[model samples]
Target: MLVRGKADRASRPNLLGDLDIPSGLSASVGISEFTYRKGQEVYSENDPAEYVYQVRKGAVRRYKLLSDGRRQIGAFHLSGDIFGLENALVHRLSAEAVVETSVRLFKRQSLENGAETDANVFHRLLSMTTKNLRHAEDHMLLLGRKSSVEKVAAFLLEMDGRLTSAGLLSLPMGRRDIADYLGLTLETVSRAVNQLQREAVLKFIGKTHREIVILDRLRLSSFDIPG
Candidate 1:
């Protein structure tokens, strides 16, 4: 990873919100910047976990390859999200930039040092780890029990809250990424999305139709998707 220098807090607010790093603890820990191109590998599985990362811009996808050549996306880390907080010495899953992305990185050892001094830092690290584990458990349940339409709906609801900006819900990742993340076929994801469009629950905007706008959130919340 190349260091692109550091950013001041004024330039990037919530630079370390995920860990809720205290000002004192954070001041002692230096942060550096790194940028990755779209589809660029951030880090591969088993790579040394020297640093913890926070998305400064764009998004990231973490996934694993199955035996039959299928890819299962475990999570999507959007702007202001912190990832790569690992207890193990190596990354458990591989991560890639969903777009041309910039990240702020701080050494894991520095964080460990901070945790040793501050009770708040230690509890914050433990809390973040627990949250990650809970999310993984929820995702596993979604994959094991939900139908394709249900999965797609859940995914849309998630992005509706996370990615909506200026009345436009722009998705950084495409259908294939969504398919892998939702554990559904690409065709199935498309069909479910189309069904939602037809029912007036959502619609794509602009000539490129890359942006989404949720129209009837009530119906979307309560509607029964046709199987």
Candidate 2:
């Protein structure tokens, strides 16, 4: 998605909201810029966690690999979201850019060192890690327990909130990725999407099927499984 000025700013959800970072910590850290094209791997599973990344533009996906090369996408990171915050020095999951994305990366060692000296930064990092864990837990429940239709509805709501701009929501990932994430087959994912469009809950921009327009949020939520 192309963005300009304030419109671009709104696309990102701030990770640093009300979180205090020591002034000294800011001066000690430096950021490197990296741009990734669609479907580019940011870092692979088992790679050394050298940096913590903050998205300056676009989205990312973090996923786990099974024994047979199947991947289950754990989360989708939108603008202003942080990824590559590892629980250890090595990454547990692989991360990839969903589009032409730019990220500001800071050395993990520097952050760790700064955190030792700054209580606020330490607390913020701990809190962020907990939040990521919680999100992963929630996604696991959704994937394991939700029906195919419910899964699609949940996915729509999430994408709508994250990527929609000017009342249009465009998905960067393909059907195979969506199926793997939702724990459904590709045909099932396509069928659910078609059903939603027919039911007037959503509409597509064109034959491409990438651009989605949600027509009725209330109806969409009604399809969500019992909490």
Clashes of 2: 0
Name the weakest run of 10 consecutive residues (lDDT summed) in model 1.
218-227
Between which residue pairs do clashes occur in model 2?
A: none
Q: After superposition, how far is residue 190 of candidate 1 from its true place, in Å?
A: 0.5
Model 2, span 63-107: residue lDDT tens:
898889787888888877888988788999899988788876777
Clashes of 1: 0
Taking all chains together, each candidate's TM-score versus the true structure is 0.89, 0.87
Candidate that scores best on lDDT: 1
Error of 2 at 198 (Å): 1.1
